[model samples]
Target: MQHLSILPILLPLFSGALLLLPPFSKTLKRQRLLAVLSMLLQVVIGFALVASVQFDGVTQYILGDWRPPYGIVLVADPMSSVMVCVTNFLAFGALCYATGYHDRTGGYFYPLFMFQVMGINGAFLTGDVFNLFVFFEVLLIASYALLIHGGGKHKTQATTHYVILNLAGSSVFLFGLGILYGTLGTLNIADMAQKVGDLEGSVAILAKIGALLLMVVFGMKAALLPLHFWLPKTYSSASAPVAAIFAVMTKVGIYSILRIHGVVFGDDAGELANVAQSWLWPLALLTVVIGTIGALASPTLKLLTANLVVLSAGTLMVCAALGNEAATSAALYYMVHSTLVAGGMFLLADMIARQRGKAEDRFVVAKTMDNPIFLGILFAIAAIAVIGMPPFSGFLGKVMILQAAHSTAEQLWVWPILLLSSLGALIALSRAGTTLFWRHSSSKQASDEKQTIHLGEWLGIVLLLGASPLLALFGGPISELTIDAAVFLHDPSLSVDALLTSPLADGGF
Candidate 1:
């Protein structure tokens, strides 16, 4: 059981290293096979971990066999478990999609992709603040490489900007960490949480400053409002799988905020908590407005990228602003839904671009919508999910967030902003859907003989789309899980109680 805790991070790290070995250098087939196997292994491990949480509650593993406040700990609570499962699922799906795209890029794609997974898993599992920074850098570095994997002038330009901006953010992150270490005398999050309330005067002030600075650094990564200029261009320029993978990157930032705010600075005396609620609300609202406007104005697939980034920021901001159990759970739900929906859409965009055989005119009719019923249906479902239609996972998640927002004094602004943002997303998506699927073209539709989707691609799409319905069926349990997770975030003592008393069961009392 203890060994299971480290498997999530170690599996990918080992697989990634093996991919770089001499024997694997020439065999793309073997490399891909290994990548898929490694990813599936991780997914299975993630599910087992989540199930463990459901049974025994939150699980913590200390590195180097040392006790808390002294040694680094990796927590496998509901929140981290949820993120790990989602990240692994998407990693597998993206890898499947990349099977078709791999030949277009060189053999290096799989290695970098695996390393990215390593980073994401590490970020989700690490219990130390400084290790969080380390894993984030790991993911960002891999992403920078993957974004420009195609090596075109446009991709190069976008990657350069993306790399530089993120590098600056990374520097800010480290500086903040330094300040935090100096003030708290410990980098362990659990220790910081326990000690943060006792610090006074100058030390407390430095801690608050450090927290705010970390927020800025993460805000850039989350692409919140004014800090989001780099997202659209960079994502638009990258290949679809790259963009899909990058979708998980924002969640890293959100995870950082949730972990740090909910755990480290959640106490009443923490001045930074107050600042997050007051300042983050206005910033979130602005991001919602600007993101929607950008989507309404843009004519390309890139618009979706911008819109989703804004939506993600708004969702996280809601979590920061509300800082309640229900609100944090809602944010977690939204994070999972948004990442999956955005990833599916990116894959759809890639499929459409591939079918057209040209990137310049993405909507050029390659085959009649009727010919590929599966593709058309999947695309429609994805579009509906992104727009938050009823009976879908997206709708349920949004409702949860709205309900959380209603619990606050700022309900007036929250309701209006959410509605307006939903409206904007609907209009922009409707226009794009019309262009991509409904619009007529002069070219003749491809015959059944000429148009086909790989079995793997179909399977991936079906599995992901099927997840929405599964979420609907298990709404009770999943909601409970998210609520439990949120509760754990709000009060770690409850998590500690569960860990100490329970044997880890399927359902909690």
Candidate 2:
């Protein structure tokens, strides 16, 4: 039971390493089997982690017999455990979809995929800020390779820009980390939370600047305004499965802001309390506005879907900026909903592109699809889910966020902007669906190239998109869980005490 806390990171680590060994390395068939099995186990372990945290309050797994504020630690709280579950479940879908044909694009796909999952899980689980930077690089390096797996000029070009921007961001992250360590004398998140309030004058100013720099890095990762130009092109250029998993990548930044800003600079931090909200609020609104406009003007389905990711990130940021338990809860529910649906949209867009010749996912008239009715159904459900329509989880998530905002002074700005952004997403997706499904040319039909949709593809799409309605179906318990997670996050003392005060007497297992 205690070891379950680390399995999410360890399973992927071991699986990825095993894939590099002789028998598995030589055979793609073997690789696929192992990767799929590994992902399934990861999903199970993810669920177990969530359940463990639910039953045991905050579960801390200290490494190397050392206690926190000194030793490396993996803390599985309600929020992080749920994020681990979402990442594994999403990875399972993306990996399944890749095995369909995309994995065949390169020999190392399975190993790289496993490493990518490992990095994301590590990012979610690590309690130390330095390790967060390390995990960020781990995922970024794997993603750089994955982005170019299929090998296209556009992909290469996009990957190049992606690599450069992130490298710069990584450098800035180090600068911020250095400043924080120098000023606060510690890098553990819980320790820093304890130390931040007591700083005054020069040291406090340095700490504040360091925090803001880190926020800039996080904002770039979340695809907030002015730093978001890389997202649409980068996402649209990748293979479908890679793009699908990348949907959760943005939420990693959202999670960071929620964790760092909420716990470290929270209202209890005295002088540093709510330091980020002033900056986060206006930028979040601009992000939604600009992102919605991008979606409206997108010329392709993948691009439009990518912009919607930006829109979702902005909306989540708004909730984070509000900085309350209710707002945090709303952000959690919406984060899961948006990540799943957006991933499905990317997969759906790829399917549509495959069926449409010459006009591949672009908003141009081509012959009707092989299964217009079926694709139309999926597209409609996706649009309704992403656009916040009734009976789906998107609407419910947005409503919760809106309801949470009512208590904040920013409700006046938050309500109209959020609702209008939903309207904008609705309009954009409706136009895209109509263009892809209804507007077909009669002149020259598509060649008799029969595209066989694989069962794995269907499984992947259904697993992700289907979660939307199911989330709405089981909204009560899920929302309560999120609220509890929010409450846990708002109180940093619990984490500090769990790690530092009451550690196990025996050495870490």
Candidate 3:
């Protein structure tokens, strides 16, 4: 029970190692089987871990039998658990989608995929700031490898820029960590949170500066405005599954912001009240505006790249500005929805490109809806989910954010900007959709022939798209869980009391 937190990190590491063995390399069929089975196991374990956290409130696993403030710790509060589930689900879906494109790459896909999962899970579960950095590096390295896996010129160019920016970000992150450690004398997040406010004078100011610098580093990773130049090029150039996987990578940035601001910085609206309301709010608005404009201007599937960046920015801004229970809940909901929809669209694009032969394969609009009905349906679902249509999870998330924004009616600017950005997203997506599906195909070949959707691809896309509704249905209970999660995050003392007062065997929170 104490070691449950390590399961998320260890499972993926173990799988990656096993897949590298000779036995698993006999054939592509065997590799696919192993990948699916391993990912399914990961998904199951992730859910179990989430359930355990809900039942126990907050579960902490001390490394090497040493207690925290001395040894490393892995904590599973509701926030980390939700992240674990989401990372693993996206990983599994991406891996499944990669099966069709395996021949395009090689035998290295599964191993790298597993390593990517290891990094994401490690970052999510670690309770130490330095370990989080280490995990981030691991994930970034895996992503770099995957970005340039097939070795095309476009991928190479894209990856070069991606690597350069991220490496610089890593340097900034390390410098900030050094400043933080020198000032605080500790790297453990729990201890840092407990002690951060007590420091005085220059040390305290330095700590705040360090936190802000770290935020900038993560903001780049999250594709925040003014630091997001690398995203469109890199995402558009990478393979579909790789781009799909990268879609969730921004969540790492969001997770860091939430953790630092809400937990380490302490959730007093008075302490950093002006900073949150002024600087962060205005910056968020800029991010939303820039991202939407980027989407509108992009001509190809590249537009999704900018659109996702915008979505991430909007979600992060809402979470940062609102900083209420409802805002955090809304951010989490939007994060989950955006990750799924964005990833699905990438995969759908991959399927379309595959059917069309090459990137340069002339754009051919589907004359009969039946010709590309499967992908058409997928595109529609993803588009609607992204655009925040009714009954979908995105709508629910937006409603929560809007409610929070309205609470601060004094800040009259929030609603209009949000509304305009929503309109911008609709227009950008409509144009992209029109170009991809409704526009007449200039190529006569498509008119003379019909392409069939592969059963595996069809199944994967449909199931993935259908998951949005299932998430919506569970919204109520999940919201309750998120509320509990937010409470625990904002005040861990409440969590400690809940855990101690409840019976251990029944896993009561």
How many clashing pairs per prediction, in order? 4, 0, 0
Better model by TM-score: candidate 1 vs candidate 2: 2
Best candidate, TM-score-wise? 2
Q: What overall lDDT goes with each candidate model?
A: 0.77, 0.90, 0.73
- Which window of ten consecutive residues has the lowest lDDT sum in model 1? 500-509
Which digits, one per residue and each the tens of the lDDT, describe model 2 over residues 335-414?
99999999999999999999998799999888878888988888888999998988999999999999988655678899
- List residue ranges in candidate 1 displaced over 4 A: 270-273, 359-372, 445-452, 495-509
User: Which residue runs does candidate 2 get wrong by more than 4 Å?
Assistant: 443-446, 503-509
Residue 419, model 3: Cα distance from true site in angstroms: 1.7
True-vs-predicted CA distance for residue 363, candidate 3, Å = 7.0
Question: How does each model score on TM-score?
Answer: 0.93, 0.98, 0.92
Task: Arrange candidates by TM-score, descending.
Answer: 2, 1, 3
Q: Note the residue pairs that clash in candidate 2.
A: none
